[model samples]
Structure formats: structure tokens, C-alpha cells
Target: MYTKPPIRKIIHVDMDAFYASVEQLDNPNLKGKPIAVGGDGKRGVISAASYEARTFGVKSAMAGNLAVKLCPELVFVKPRFERYHEISKQIRAIFHDYTDLVEPLSLDEAYLDVTENKKGNPSASLIAKEIRARILNEIGLTASAGISINKFIAKIASDYNKPNGQKTVNPEEVISFLETLDIRKFYGVGKVTTEKMYQKGIFTGLDLKQKSLEYLDTHFGKSGRYFYYIVRGIHNSPVTPNRQRKSLAAERTFSENLSSEIFMLQKLDHIAEEVSNRLKKSKISGKTITLKIKYSDFTLHTRSKTLTYFINDKALILDTAKDLLYQESLNNSVRLLGISLSNLNTEAKKNTAGLSLNKKVSVQLKFDF
Candidate 1:
């Protein structure tokens, strides 16, 4: 007689308004008030906003001036990346106490596989609760979690209850949970994809499920198969620790548009130095150099060159960027400039713990958490 495969237990944990919350936690005066973490200048953008700020339509990536207009009392604070990273390390240490299979998506969120955790506790939901509580007690920060059978569903579930809450989607409920989900709430679906989905009369997971695989593939290219499988609750990706870095980049947005190449050269030199320093710090190198240009009208352009040999030298990177800069005439005055290196030397580790897509969800199986 064959035995059924055990369902994988995955948990996604996300910190609540991380950057702004950090600022508030460190400064009592900023608590319970609308605050943003970023520069407050003509070209400044809000990197993060507190829950109070969010109520007033202040949000991350929104222009600082616009955020101020939306909420007259919005407070702008400079980002403290070093402090955030320090706190993130503390959070990751807490995660490792429960499981070794932790995949960090960013400093604020991660995916943990607690099926065979160090705690030896069978309930993933309890593990998530314990982790969140530890974060709060030890680091003085609140976290939210979503527990499910896979990363995709867990990630979406984590956002269901924001600002310090947890949600669990049992194996039996995965199909129904996904079917009723709003198209916009699906992890990878963005504004452009949502509009495209609406145009195709697909507003929910159920509607997407109704489309044939061939239709999805034809209309959505490679992403069609992804949608087809995920709606049916068939994601098999495993939690991977130490995900490889794909690219390194540095960019600057000018307060005023610059029309002259001389001015752009100075900016490019600074950017290339930053990128080269970062690459050296990480002990990584790449062959492809891409120069990104954003005109005053917001039109974007990119030029790239892939070298036979990898480079992490600032002079070489600057020379390549300068060549790309003069490769074509300026369409208009440039408002932003960026340099990025891809095709890195880092190797990706193979994950051998993926769940089987062929495994069936059994209602008879005990749902513990």
C-alpha cells in the first residue's frame, strides 16, 4: 500500500510598515503620527510610510511634495539603512530558531518552511505566532504572517491581516481561498496585468481558472501556465535559503534636468564608483553593463554592452557607461541616470526539497494548524 505524501507547511512573515515603524520605535515623538522615511525635497520620494500616514493617502514611492499636499502634517525622516539591516539580522536569527529553511525576500519579509522545524512542533501556525511574538518582545516590532501549503498562497495570505495579525489557509481550503481571491491580490499581478485581466473579463481567480491553458499561454505568454497552476493551488516551489543576487546597481535622480554631457559625465562617475564599491564589497563581478536614462518628460531609455571578461573596476565601468551615454543623441534633458551590472559571477544553489505537483490534497488528512 502506498502512503500519501505529507503536505508542506510554509509561513510568510512580513514586518508592518518597516522603515517608518523603525523610525517611530526609535523616536517616541513620531509615534501615532503620519510619518514618511525619505528625503523631503522637490524630487524626494517617500520610501516608507507609517500606518497613520497611509490613512492620509501617504504611501511608499509617492512624491514627497504630493504626500505633503495629501496630508499637511506628514513628517519626513531620513532613511537609516544601517539600523534597518541591524534589526533585520535580529529578525532572521529568530527565524532560524524555528527552521533552517528560511528564504528572505527582503529585509522586511521572508518565507519559512516549518514542516520539519528545529522546534519539532507540528503546527506551523503556532510557530508563526511564536516567531511574531518573539520579534515583538525582543526587537520591539510587530509582524504579520500567513500559513499555508506553499510560498505563493502563504505570501498572499500574510497580507490578509495587516499590522500584527496572522491567517492560516488549511490544505483543504487552498482551492476555495484562491478561487475567491481578487485578481489584484494575486502576488505577481500588477496594475498593468490587472488592467489586462479586466479587459479579458478576468477579475477573480475563478475567472482565471475558467480560461483554457492554451488561451492563457497565447495571451499571457509564459505567465499563462503560472496562472493556470496557481489558481488550482498547485505551486510547488520550495523555501530556498541564501537566494543568489542577480544584479547590482546604483542610480541618482537629479532635482533639475541636465542637458549637457559634461554634467552627465560627473554624475556617471559618481554612480559608477558607487556600483563598483558595492560589487567589491560583495566580492562579485559581472559582464553586462546597462545605462538607464530617464528624460525630463519621463521617457526612459537603456543601452547595454556585455563584455567577454567580467569586470568590477570603476574606471572600466565608467568608460562603458560614457560610451553608452554618447551612443545616441539625447532625446531630451535627462532627469535620472542609473548604471547596473548583470550576468553576475554568483552561482545559484539547487533546491532539492520541492513539493510534488502531483500530490493530491486530501480532506481526510488531519489539518493541525
Candidate 2:
């Protein structure tokens, strides 16, 4: 039986340097300058950097000292979480005005399904443009949008012209557009996977499309199947709305590794504080506490303990994290420490209805996110 492919209209909207842009908007003096939002301590990591800062190699997750070295004139500002959250809610409200199906990835990015929008408009590209325009006019921030038949293509197209621009990939042009795209630009292809793909001569979507499924599966495991289908413009992951968070976590890496157990415990205390604060802010609790440790040599290990009851207390989290820490001896000096709470008690929501790709094409949709 041959079925036609199901077609959907998805739009991915990503803010341009969200935090930095907000900072720049709030303060006129910071405009047109290389700025980053994060702590400036020796061990601090960048949370976000403006486009001006990015040109000099400053990037999120980079060490503060390294970012300073990259751009000598870079300015650092403390993050204002409360303001960012308020703005995020405002942006989401704008999305709800158009469609009810909006999946937020973070405070800055989201995937919106506008196949049947509230305004009765048939053009997805026009809706995306209006959304971006609303964001700029109402909130005083710039956003880029991408419109396509599915989430995968929409996400990639969203990055084509960043910093207040929009791109649309019509269903008919998806295959050719993907052919020229670099394999590295594909979702789920990380640095390690990109290097592996380069070694296998899979540099672009076209090269990847030429590989056999069996060969891909053998080389890339289950992800190989994803790569094979995605390169052929076959991603079907829906824009899930009102998704419950499965976990909350916080972690930090130190500038210098520590071998002392006492030093590690001190770091765990800070990590516990972070995780507890996040849990409280979300008004959620969980039973499982996981402790992740990364050694100076880059080796990683994790220990977790599931409690009988949910907890979000800082002291309890710290105690549980400490117990997990001592469960395993320190194999090497630690470079990073993290704590996470899972097995949450949030309300579960599922979308049972499935969309038809085409009457002839049958896809076994598996929920992965």
C-alpha cells in the first residue's frame, strides 16, 4: 500500500541572542557593543553573548577567561532571570494568539504548529512574519522565523538568516534544500558525530542520503536511522504543546580541578543550591537525585538514588547529592559536578491524535522527546 505523505505547517522562532538583546534593550549604553550575560569570575561560564561578542569567538558555555581572551573588549553583565521569564511568557502569549500548539525549547526558542491557525490564514510564511513583527513592535526585540512542512526543516531554515530575518522552505523545495546543507547543520549531529560523519565521507545531506540504512544503522546505531530519514526530508516529530518537564538540573565546571573530597563537597553544595532554586521556581518536586561528575581527564561517571518521596529542599538535595558522591571513590580529580532531580510529579499530558503524512505513506511515530 502506498500512502501520500502527511503535510504540516511548522514555524520555528528563535530570538537573536535573547539575554544579551534584552540587556541591550534595557540599557541604551550597551547597544552595539560586544556583551555577554553571565558571571565574570575565573571559573564562570558564559550563558549568552551578543552577536558582536560572537564574532570574536565568545560563545555560551565557554569559560569566562577564555571569552575575555577571545574578545578583549567584551563586556559582562549579570543575568536578570525574572525579566527574562516575564518576557518569555509574553512571547508565548503572542504564540497562543495564533495557535494552541506551541512547543517551547527554552526562554528563547519555540516550535509552533500553524496548520489550522486562529486567524483562518492559509499562509504559514505570512503568519511567521507577523509573529516576528509583533515581537519586535511589542516587546522591542528581534526574532528570526522559519517556516516549513515539518519541525526538522523548519528548525534548520530558521538559522539560515539569523538576527531578525525569516526563511521559508516550501514542501516541494525541501529535498533540494537539504541536499546542499552541511551534515553538521543537521539536528542531533554533535561535534563527535560530525567528525565521524566527515570520516565516512558524509559531508552533506546528499552524501548521507546515498548511504544504505543498514550501513548507517551499523555505524551510527539508532541515530543512524534518524539521520538517514532526516536527510531525505522525512522527520515527523510533532510540535508538542504543554510538555511537562521531566527533570531540573544545574552543573558547573571549575577552572582548576580539585582532588580533595572536602573541595568536591563544597562544589556540590553550590550545585545543590542551584538545583533546589530551579525546582522551587518551577513549583515541582521529584524523588530521584542524580550526581554527575566529570574528571579532569574528561572521563564521566554518574550516581543516582531514588527516594520514597518527592523533595525540593536544598538541604535534602545537598545531603542526597553528598551520599551519591561518596558511594563511589574519586577515580581522578574532578573538573565538573552536577545535581539533577527527576521522577517529577507534574501533570502528564499526551496527544493521542496522529496526523496523516499521506494516505499512501505509513510512518511508525515513536515519541522520543
Candidate 3:
């Protein structure tokens, strides 16, 4: 009989209160004070809240008004995306130093598969310790790490020790540790699902793992399969690298609404020109031109037209947007109008490819991408 080894080592690293913590770290005067990163108005929502704000029930996505009501003295600050991204790059570099199997969940958290790490150390606990230490020493931040056999249990264990903490769960420890976990603490189980689990008498992991696949599927649909395996501390998802961007869009809110078609046409032309410049810069092209409009009463509409081939020319882009806008039945004063392009084409047509030298030069000018 062949017996399998009982322990597999995985690590989950999560930065502490990421955005607001960065803001506080850069500014000493803001230390120990409740902080939120977002707009400070009735229409705004808290993007991130520091631990201090969380102590008063302030949380991310809470309306700014409600967040303030909970913590009257909370300080609001705008998000610094560029700086945060730079810091994120720094931390990811540290991850790559150990293992290439790093799956970033967000700017603040990632899962690292260290079964065969670059450090050649058998103990994942020590690797996690060094990684956390390096992040603090190099980035002036605190992070928590959890080590287990797979992503499922590793993620759960990471949160077990937070705010400059780390924990490890061996294979034997997985079943026993998970048996007592709150149903709400399970990853991918959000509020509604949590309620449903409670209703099904699945208050803990033992209750979850005990259910048959057919029974769980009958109750929870497709996600039931995922829950079934997570309860058993089995996760098959691998660390995927960053995905290429398929499309990009830009929009704006006007200072005041304008009803004039001529004004909207002018705005669309400028937007098209900007998109053309970007297309040239990125060496990309799209066949689809989409026109979007928002009315003063908050109603919205969009129209799109896809050409036979991609184009990066400014005139072609503006003409397509203009045609789409003319087709729409506008009944109200438009507050904002925007244009976007998608469905990229990266090659010239077959006939155009074998064109004469002068024709080739002309086509290249008309289609810079």
C-alpha cells in the first residue's frame, strides 16, 4: 500500500486595511485617527476605511453620509491609485522572489503556492514569516499570512491571524479546524448565501462537508459543488497571471446639462479625437464604435456600430459616433455624452496586404495601428 504525505504548504498574504493604512503610513499626523478614502458628499461612498473607522461601524461601500454618521470625526481623503499600484508592484516582486505561483486577489491580497519554492526551504511557516517581515521593512506596512495544504484552507487560516500575524494548518489540522468555522467565515459565501446555509442547518464546516453532492446541488445550484470541496479543504484553482485588457472606456459628468445636438456633436468629435490618439499610442484598433448619452433626469442610452475591419483614424471614429447619435430618439436634455470603441482588428484586409508600395503607404497612414 502507498501512503500519501499528510502536509501541503500554501500561503495567503493580505495587507492590513490596505488603502487607508497607506494614507496613514505616509502621514504621521493621521495616525490613530479614523480615516476613509473616497468622496465626501451625499452621492459618494466610502472606498476604504481604516481599522479605526471600522471600530465605529464604518465600512467600505457605505454611503459617505452613513459612514460619517457612524464616525463623526472620521477624516475623508481621496484615493491615491498610482502610489498604491507602485506599492503593490513592490510587494508582488517580493512574492516572485519565492514562487512564480502568485495569484493576486486584489491590490492587497494574494495566494502563493510554495510546494516547491525558490528558497528551497521545506517549512512554509518560515517563508511566510520572512515575506511578511520584508513587506513591513521595505514598504512600511503590516500583513497577515496563513499556510495550509491548499488555497481554500490557506485563505481561511490567513484571516485567522490578521494585522501583522501568521498561522499554519497542517493536513491533519484542516478537518478539525474547519469543522468549527462560522458558516459566514467561508470564502465565496456572502450574506444571502450565509442566510441560506443557516436555514439548511449548515452552521459549521462539519455540517457542510457531511452533505452529499446531490443534496448540496439541489439546495445551492452550481455553487454547491464549490462549497462541497472547500469544506473538505480541497481547491484546484491555480495562480493565473494578469489578463490582458480587452477594452477601455472613459466618461465624464458635465457641470450642467445641455440640450443642443450641435454641442453634443462637438463633444463627441473631441472624444473621438482623443480615442484616436490613444489608439495610435497603443498600436491598437477597434471595429465597433459605441455612443453613450445620459439625460438630465438620469435616463441613459447607447448605440453601437461595428465595421467590417478595425480602424484607428480620427475621422472614421467621429463619423461612426455621429451616425449612432443621429439614430437615437433624444427626448430630454443630455447631461453627458461619451464615445468608446471596441472589437479590435489587428490586421489589414487580404487585398490590402498585397497593395503597391504607394498604396501600402496610403493604407498605413489611414490606419496607423
Candidate 4:
């Protein structure tokens, strides 16, 4: 006799308009009003928009000016990361009470694997409900949760019910659920990819599933292979716990756009110093350095170079960033400068031995403007 594979239980918990909700919770006066958490300055980016604000077409990451135009009565509040971190800890602790296999996606979202939970609860749906309740009762904030056989379905389900609701997708319903999901709703499918999929006559998961693996691989490359499997509900990527940071970065937006090379270099130096200091504190080095530039018009560009050896020195980071900056002519006045280090060497001591011996080597900067 042949046996079927056991279904895994996964839950994705996401806080609802986390920052905006927190602002309302802390200040009762802000409740039931259109509020946005972020700066309201000229270069300010909306971090989170309340449901009320969303009604007025306000959204996070939208320019402050544009958001204001969308909602004239919008209230902007500066973000309090320290407070958010504290709340995240409290939420994570609650997740630990049910299972240790918790993978945090951000301060407001996490994936929990409870195939064999500590509570001995067989129903992942009940567990998700309880977790959402605990967050509301204890943290005084609302959270939404999704329960399914795997992370992919659970993550998408979590968004189905908004603002203090939960949804569960049983194993039997996975196929139908995926079939009806829009292609844009698929993970990692952005505007460009969505347009490409439309051009290929793939507008939904069902359409995507119709393509052969060879055809998808040829057109979408690595991502094509991912789409092929995901549409068929074949995602087996485990919910990773304690995911390592692939990069550490620091960035700053200036009050005024800087056009002079001297002024731009000065900002790059500070940004590089900040990134190097962070790498030092983390006790890591990286081979790849990325320079992020945001133009005055809010267009973004990045230039990256992978070095021959890992480095975490302030002077080296500054020099590398300066060189990358000079390699490209400014298409527009720069308003923000940032430096990031990736391909991290976690074993800092191993790389330190050859740190002094490592020489400066140039790699062509890859541009994404």
C-alpha cells in the first residue's frame, strides 16, 4: 500500500496598517481619522497609511506631496522604530508560546510552522485565531492571519481578510484557491513581470500552470522555474528561522539636492562610514558594495561592485563608494546617498588575517537606473 505525504501546517500573521494603527492606539485622538505614519516634508515618503487614508488613495511609499494632494486632511506622524521593535518582540514572544519555528518577515509580519506545535493543537486555524486575539488583547493592536498547508498559500490568505480577520485554506482547496489568484498576486511578481506575463497570455495562476516547465524556464529564466512550481502548489521552501541579514546599509536624504561632486562625495563619505560602523558592530565583512542614489525627482539608481576580498573598513568603504560615484555621470540632481555591504563574511576573524594584504581591485559597476 502507498501512503500520501502528510500535510504541513503553516500560518502567516500580518499586522494591519501596523504603524498607523499603533499611532491610533497611542493617541486616542488620532483614532477614526485619516493618518499616515512618516514624514510630511518635501522629500518625505509615506511609511504607512491608515485604512481611512487608503480610502483617499493614500499609500505608503508615496511622496508626501502626492499623498497630500490625494488627501488634503491627511495627518502625518513620524515613525517610532523603538516602539515598533518593542511591540514586535511582544508579538514574537506570543508566537514562541505556540511554536519555536517562527520566521519573521518584518516587524509586523511573520510565518509560523506549527505542524507539531507545543500546544498540541492540531488545527492551525485555531492557533492563528488565538495568536491574533492575543496580539489585540495584549498589544492593543489588530492583526490578520492566514492558515494553510504551506507558506505560499498562507501568506496570500493572510491578506484576504483585512484588519482583524483570519482565513484558512485547506489542502483540498489549495488548487482552486491558486487557480483564481491573479498573476500579480503571486510572490515576487512585480509590474514588469506582470506585463511580461500578460504579453505571454498568462494572467492567472491557472494560465501560468498551463505553461510547460521548459517554456517558463526559457522565458522567465530562474524565476520562470519558480513560477512553474508555485502555480502548481509545489512550493517546498521551508519557513526559515533566524534568517541572516544579507546586507547592512545606511542612507540619508538631504534637505536640498546636491549637484556639486564635492558635496556629493562628502555625503557618500558619511554614508559609507555609517555602513562600515554597522558592519563592525555586527562583526562581519562583505565582498559586495552597493551605492544607492535617489534623484531630486525621486527616481532611484544603484551601482554595485563585488570586490576580490571582504572588507569592513570605513576608509575602504568610503574609497569604494567614491570611485563608484565618479564612474557614472549624474543624470539628475541627487537628493539621497546610501551605501550597503552584502555577501557578508560572518566569520570576521577568518577574513581579518588577509585584510591588510588585500589590494584595491576594480570591478565594473552594474547599473539599475
Best model per lDDT: 1
Candidate 1, residues 1-369, lDDT tens digits: the string is: 223434789999999999999999999999999999984845676899999999998899787778988999888999999999999999999999999999999999999999899998999999999999999999999999999988998999999999899999998898789889999999889999899999999999999989988899999998887898788786767788977888999888788889999999999999999999999999999999999998987788999999999999999999999999999999999888999999998956555344344554333235676
Lowest-scoring 10 consecutive residues by lDDT in candidate 3?
Answer: 360-369
Pairs in clash, predicted candidate 4: none
The lDDT values for all models are 0.90, 0.88, 0.79, 0.84
Model 4 per-residue lDDT tens digits across residues 1-369: 222223678899999999999899999999999998885746777899999999999998788888888888999999998999988899999999999999999999999999889999888888898999899999899999988877888999999989799898787677788888999998789999999999999999999988987899899997876786677666566777876677899888777889899998888888888888889888889999999999987799999999999999999999999888988899999888989999887622222111111332121122110
Q: Order the candidates by lDDT, highest first — what do you get?
A: 1, 2, 4, 3
lDDT of 3 at 39: 47
In angstroms, the error of model 4 at 113 is: 0.3
| Alpha carbon RMSD to native, model 4 | 10.1
| TM-score of each model, in listed order | 0.92, 0.86, 0.70, 0.90
**Candidate 3: misplaced stretches above 4 Å?**
1-8, 243-369
| lDDT tens digits by residue: candidate 3, 74-136 | 899988989899899999999999999888888999988787889998788899999999999
lDDT of 3 at 198: 89
Q: Considering every candidate listed, which one attains the maximal TM-score?
A: 1
RMSD of each: 2.9, 4.6, 13.4, 10.1
Error of 2 at 95 (Å): 1.3
* lDDT score at residue 313, model 2, on the 0-100 scale: 98
Q: Is candidate 1 or candidate 2 better by TM-score?
A: 1
Clashes of 4: 0
